[model samples]
Target: MGFCSYKSFVILFCLIFTPLTKADLLSATLNYHQGSYSEAKREFLQLAHLGNADAIYNVAVMYLHGQGVEKNKAQAFAWFSLAADFGLLDARDTAMLIAEQTDNKQPLDDAYNALLKQLSFQWYDQQLRPELNASPALHLSPERRYTVEPKYPEHAYKNGIEGWVWLEFDIDKSGAVTDITLIDSYPEKTFDKAIINAVRRWQYQGNNQTLPYYNRSLLYHFTTYKGKQYEQSFKSQQREYNEKISDLIDAAEQGNALVQYYIANWLSSNDYNATRLLKYHWQQANANGELLLRSAVNGYANSQYRIGANMLRGKYGKVDREKGLNWILLAAQSGFASAQYRLGRELLNSQYVDYAPNKALKWLRAAAEQGLFSAKRDIALLLFDLKKPMQQVSTALNEALAGDNEHPQLLLLKAKIHAATGNSNDARKLSNSALKEAQTRNWDQSSIRHFIATLP
Candidate 1:
């Protein structure tokens, strides 16, 4: 906290006050920076409830050093352990020291035991993602009870900046939108704030109880046509596009990757009818798709990803599995975080790509290193499974927990690790906790239960 440069403080202030970021995170950081320790602590507590790792770590730090709060080592230890379980490196180190100190007083490894207990406790996702994808058995993404519509940006409307932005977010167990990432935006930053603000006000019924979070994404399209505007709307119609289609050809020709993608998008927008699960690829040679192909050839990572993804879906043309994977790999190799994550995830989970644990770990590690929270969590599970070094396991696990503390895969791996280390009590505790959480998340728990039975 004290080591930040003036530039860092200025950047922090920008992140805190930036309209595009969440208000709670903004307020909390502002409090921290303004020497309002107690106020910051309270705001950070609010973020912790949403399962934000940074907030959890801040709260732990406050308790550890008594900044704006009374010093309580046990409280600090618990909070730190929780944060560590979610992959907070600082928290992991501090929690270890606190654990050691606590145990020395007890003449045993009780501090470590306490730390282990904290680790075993359920770490909520707080809406970064759903540990459980919606399936027949896993009833997630409950019906929307209330949704606050996002306002169309006046500036955008006036300027005829009409296109869509891709957004991904999670509806928490309590049916609140927690984590949101702008996957892509057309016309760059025009309507990002508008779309994000609107999505945040949405509320869900959440399975009539506290079900696990649900991961969802949608296209927030801003459209202006015939000199008329609509106050931002969600649409699945990829073919029904904006009026700016004619202007993108020049931008695409200018070698702008973003513009190239948008140009390709505009050109191909009306060609495919994926909405009906039908396609017409043999009908004509369209410049829209050709423009995209050219952009892909130009080594634009975003275009590569888009083209790869589009081909995989057989949207713009026939399904080109080989070409699709090649583009995806190109994008991934170029260090696109999303592409790296997608490639890594496929390799990790045996998706369309073959399962290559080592490769998956490497690619995922790359993405995680770039600050992709989901990738960090995924790598922790992958690393643990690979039986890599213990330090690595601990580090990856701690990092992964920051976003998804109760991830089922991580829990199972931790349980196995505890059992291998001969901490039978800890193993049993974590195993039981894992099963309960998995069941609550409506995950397939047969494997987990089997593992538990084999443990002494």
Candidate 2:
């Protein structure tokens, strides 16, 4: 049979064996089994773009065995690493195995890191699904059999850069750490690799009686010992700031709103006061809040917004909804885009306030006019909810999508617009594409699927 005919036959067989949504995957698998390596590779690549973990792993295998592509272990490693990140255990094991076998693993590591960075844009494209409360938290803490301290990166040390990295990993049944993820970091990415490398070599005590622990969190702080000479330099800098601070305090006392705001910020900063300054000259309990209040009283819009936001969240003390809203309104009235957006969101969501959709739309529009993509997205959503004209909704969505086309929620909204406009095929295709993107991020797709099902 001709190649196209054979491909059709394989697809037909796949339809019999799998759901229509997964026919493409089964078809690709059949093609691979039939020794049509090139065809299988092509199909897998297409599916992989939609974030299919199985297709991603199959692509890595084909690259590893030189079935359809040239034998490139580095490429295979990159693909396997990506597949592992997509939650494939086999891919994770294969990636680690390849790393162990490779002489001079730097190139493979580089390939993997590079691929991750290249694909990092998709990380923020979808909102994560809320996990069900299925499993209880681990009661017993695992004992460490071996621990390795991460070495400070020479470049970072020389530059006097200090930061901390937070990581989350799982301890497998064999007591080896696996699926290590960098949760967050200060001076981001600088200490990420150092922490990840160290954690991978750590060994934990395995027990037959207990299940392996998952989502173990660890934070590593990288501090530099700046030596006596550096300490002297730091003291000198502190002396200089001390000399200048008295004049600033005088200005702040004289009702210089900007100076008051500046002093408030410096006083509030833990980093500035603890590590870099002689706090004796300026320290006062709740002084930052006092100064911020003074500045806001003197009509500093930024100070008003900061105090309002802090009050709303109870960052300094107790939450005061009425006072916080008043302060935020003052800032928004002064045309602060961020304050405008915040007020709009709070109004729309009835967060510490009554729902006022019209008022929310007004502030959102003001913020959107100042070029905030998030504000534009909110404006589109508000307009849609208000059952405004389709043209206005489309215009707002188009503007927002221009800023971030990969946003799954916006894409799904666009699909809804298409469905409303009597474009069922386009609606289905766009919805499916959005669903695939959301799946790649492991987001909940039940609502999206329901919407798709309702469409013609």
Candidate 3:
């Protein structure tokens, strides 16, 4: 009679608790076997909610492994305890094992509190699936490529622009853009044409169909940098020139060191309040560079080199060669080509290092390998200085001239080499040609002229 009662209770327990569909249970089983613990946990949790005995066991396994849940021996015991409550034999065995390992009559004291938190958060989890639906691009074809274009008007916008345009487009099955329209980028007819012209050329691939049909809406924003709706025609030139100053001024005023650096560089060449602006921008860039160095410590090689070089040049500041050299070395090691060249030139000119020639040669060679044309020319010049006999110099010069024979620096070097070796005719020919090319390109011509004058 006792055996019969136990057997009947076992059958009743299985019937009441095992509500999981075969597909869901099978997915959980496959995931568990495949070592996809997080995925298995999700599937098992779903079945556990449906009162599946097997799923409850699997969820305990997930807790044991801390897969998508906190690793809590107590929580694992609690889950096993729940299954055991219904007279599950396997659950009874596992729960006893967990209890022994935890050394407790009940699961740990914190397990109940954590379980309460999980129950309270259940509604929050339920609301997440719909929110996920809004971002279906995650499940769409990964093979598809989307080209992004910023929604800037192709033509500049002027002030007094009104009206909203709507752009509706579809991504096709082939992942190409179609049915694109100008969606309220402008108000006036002229401005609208600019937006429409840009839209017609834009392409995209759609997700829902085998080929995209127009079904989506996109927004574009165009901001006016300058020009009021009724700016007189005479003020157009002023607007075009002064508009360049707006962002530069804002960045400078806001103490953005990077922008300040660029503004300083620009003002150094241009004479409009050039000295004052140059000093102010350089000071800000220096302060910003110092702050950045503390965090990155030799990072931002360009910033280090720029600030260092400015200090070296003593432009509106005291010169500090030691600090400049240290920063320059950092920049050179980090592969800033300009810094590499400058460091090589400086160290070589100082001639204090034991292997100064080899060091300069190595740095120049590195910069040249990166396809920096000036660095290539520098290497050729170094080879000319090092190689014995006129033929070797000629070979190096020819190699340097291969890609850019018309470059002023190489031509000047060639002229010098030819003149040094008494090839007056070749020297005169090369120098005269270089002078003309330099003048046309608006490059500095004084050095080329000097070489030509020395030819005789």
Evaluated with lDDT, which candidate comes out highest? 2
The residue-by-residue lDDT of candidate 1 on 200-312, one tens digit each, is 77776656454444335466656555122322421322233221222233334433334445545544444222111111221234554555555554445776676665555
Q: Write the per-residue lDDT of candidate 2 for residues 1-456, one digit (tens) a residue.
A: 322132110111111222222224556776899999999899777656544566778889998999989988998999998888877888889999999999989889888788776553254123111111122233445778999999989887766666667566666555767556554565558889998888888878857543366546565666664434366755655554444454555555644556565556555544432223324645666666777766665556676777666555555444555566777887788787767877887787553447798998999899889887768877887788789999999999999888778666688899999999999999998999888976764444666888998997
Q: Taking the tens digit of each residue's C-alpha lDDT, what string does model 3 give over 399-447? A: 6687687866688778778788888998888888888976665444766
lDDT of 2: 0.67
| Candidate 1 vs candidate 3, lDDT winner | 1
The Cα RMSD in angstroms, rounded to one decimal, for candidate 1 relative to the true structure is 23.8
List where candidate 2 sits over 4 angstroms from the true fold: 1-229, 236-238, 273-278, 350-353, 440-446
Best to worst by TM-score, what's the order? Answer: 2, 1, 3
TM-score of each: 0.47, 0.50, 0.37
lDDT of model 1 at position 334: 76
Ranking by lDDT: 2, 1, 3
Number of the candidate with higher lDDT, 1 or 2: 2
Model 1 regions lying over 4 Å from their true place: 1-162, 167-182, 187-220, 224-248, 266-288, 316-319, 349-355, 406-408, 428-456
- Candidate 1: C-alpha lDDT: 0.60
Return the lDDT, model 2, position 242.
Answer: 48
Candidate 2 weakest ten by summed lDDT = 7-16
